[model samples]
Target: MTTETPAPRHETDVTSGPGAVGAAVAAAREAQPWWAGIGFAGRKKALDAWRVLILRRADELVDVIRAETGKTADDARLEVILVADHLRWAAAHAGKVLGRRRVPSGLLMFNQSATVEYRPLGVVGVIGPWNYPAFIPIGPVSAALAAGNTVVLKPSELTPAVGQWLADTLAEAVDGPRVLRVVTGSGETGAALCRAAVDKISFTGSSATGRRVMAACAENLTPVVIEGGGKDAMIVAADADLDAAADAAVWAAMSNAGQTCVGLERVYVVSEVADRFLRLVGDRAAALRTGDRPDADLGPIVLPRQLEIIKAHVRDAVARGARVVLGGTESFTPPYVAPIVLADVPEDSVALTEETFGPVLVVNRVTCVDEAVDQVNASAYGLGASVYTGDRSQGRRIAGRLRAGMVSVNAVIAFAGIPALPFGGVGDSGFGRVHGPDGLREFTRTQAVTSQRFRPLMQPNSFGRAPGTMQTLVRMMRALYGR
Candidate 1:
């Protein structure tokens, strides 16, 4: 008797370099029509399946996240939990957000009936970052999937396995393997995805890379969404809660080892409470521990190369006469960086002007909230801001004046948790929202349909119109909108 040889299972790498992008995009486009034809109800069922699996198996997702990113389990948990929440929200809300809506035809087109609806763009490409590997791409992917567009995700090479696992998990639950796929590779893969034939590209990473993504997409005249780097600022008003503000600042600056784009990097406290706020914040920062231990409050900087940037920023700040109120260069122990708080930092220091992306915070004093608002708006990065003020009216007033995309009146990094709030930035920080109704619509194209319901009194559209019709239309235009 002859022994039979087992057949080998094979898989293709859709992330080998520039070549992978085309295959990934093609597969997604081919799958999109059938998936979209299922409409909102079918999509909701699939999304619900994904949400259920993600929540039920959160522990498994957390372990994978920790293994890939080196973030503490708790920090990793937050990302997975938030991703589940977004998937739930997208499933529950996409129907209403993308449903057809009727609108008034207005005076000039009174005889017409008009309605508008969002249609899926067929395929979408997403380039994710390593800091929040399990969470970041899900934002765009969920939104796109909910909108009926298949997605091709290129996760950061640092966390490709996590990306693959995520795709596999969702596909296994919904039996929609072709609806979503992962392409794991370096920057070249991302650039190729942009150049590939896709409806749109959503990128989350440094602003420098965002610019390149935009350039690559431009080659195909493809639309792009970017969530770029930020040097976010915080303001502590004179009437604010010093203790609460300090605690929030320290947590925001040190959370996820300060790898967050919207994390606190600079603070402008009113002169009246500057000293007290600085003392409270410095003490809290100094007390924060960094390690991979289960009980550790903070984790190491996940990206190995980010260490140099962190050290360089600290050195530049010190050279510019910034005083370290807490940890200094000594905190540059490899892998982990203890919380560092600087006081009396020059306005032009690198720590304040650039994204440190580490456990670093710089504090400055302002005479009043107005000056603080102006200073915060002065930064080229208009991603997000936090304002701690006792008065609601003052908080609203200052929040309105800030140029950032989102502002938390009395909290830090609170907007990102609410699934209905559109999260994005203005200026160099990046454009295109990734949550709420706007986010769902971002993956679709608008189609306005108009039908003539009746004959209008003007009848100017017909060549057979009366000679005086043109004069009457001109008179109406002058009466209604000439001013």
Candidate 2:
């Protein structure tokens, strides 16, 4: 969920129009064959060069991310570091993950050998969010390139500078014009990309805008992977490490101003330790700072309009018998929104149900881990969740029952940091995956090829078969199966 707060209302510049969108997609298609022809080894070499370049200029990239997104320097640095790791992983592993592999023919086709390979989807279109501008769009871009497809990316208008930096840096690693191109504009530009003839589209934003992206892609029947909103929860079991869980919740809720798709928004603590958990969480939240300073805990909300949504959620929750245990809506001063912790927030209130893209944490007491699971699963968005328990097995058991796409048993947002892990969500949180082997395949088309190793004793597909062939086959099936 990036800059769904909406871009400035204005007409987009060059490369932001429908004509430019179409031209970029057409150029990507033209360039894809040469990219795929270079083969995995060549692509890997180029991608590794790209990684080296990013590492060398990582400081510059981090500064751009922080400057554009208003996230703390360390937070922005984390994203840059993570993206570098993924670039390395994708380039190094794409061959093994997507290469053709032999498959045993089933009994009916024993005379044949089959194999499957993942082929590039030609041209890939990506629309990224502003929150994690450098990392979010780059996930799809790297996977697509590694999978041998050319890419055309449209970054959030709010952070086009970072997007431009990424595209330009990648271009230095290769000798191509439009292998990767950046388009900057409002929703209209995104709409143009969706309407353009692209093989697939990868979008990360609000569920509402994702729906619109899906609708626009439907005109061309372009397949899409929508990485949308999440009202993720943090479960605190009776046997959990209270201090660790509280600390994790604090960073998860307040870091990046809680604008993360998998950020912690709700907590369901067992009644036995609910009070202690609340105290710890409140202490951590109260101490956290959100200013434009160098050493602040977090930064301002990049999207200006997100303040209203944050304000409305806090106001609604307070109006419905909820108490602000820490900061309130009054702390919002334009882009900077301090962490706001709420207690006894109603189950159906906006604070609990909606995606308040701000530093807000809501706590609810559960009778047991089972009740906590039930409460967490009740959310409409299930992108990700975190479970804290002293018993590792109990954490796994609870994690298995949660409907989120990713679950971190002992840590918060650990799955995202692992480049080999498949990251995405189920239901409204969005469908499809990015990162890992699944991510490599996400932008590819599966092709199954077969070869006849020997002549079949009986050719059922042949018209020259004897009249009694059907009768004999039926008898053989009955004898083999009808015991």
- What TM-score do all the candidates reach, one by one? 0.94, 0.96
Task: Identify the leading candidate in terms of lDDT.
Answer: 2
lDDT of 1 by residue, 120-142 (tens): 99899999888888778888999
lDDT of 2 by residue, 1-483 (tens): 633556543333433645577777787788889999999999999899889999999999998887677788889988989889999999999999999999989756789999999999999999999889888887889999999999999988877887888888888877765578887777888999999879999999999999999999999999999998999999998988999999999999988889889899999999999999999999988888779787799798877788888999999999999987898967888779988989888899988888988899999898888988999999889899999999999899999999999999989999999999989998888999999999999999999999999988877778998678778778888898879
> For model 2, which pairs clash?
none
- Badly placed stretches (over 4 Å) of model 1 are 1-15, 474-483
The alpha-carbon RMSD values of the candidates against the true structure, listed in the order shown, are 6.4, 2.0
After superposition of all CA atoms, the RMSD between model 1 and the true structure is: 6.4
Shift in Å, residue 349, candidate 2: 0.5
> Number of clashes in every candidate structure?
0, 0
Worst 10 residues of 1 by lDDT: 1-10
lDDT of 2: 0.88
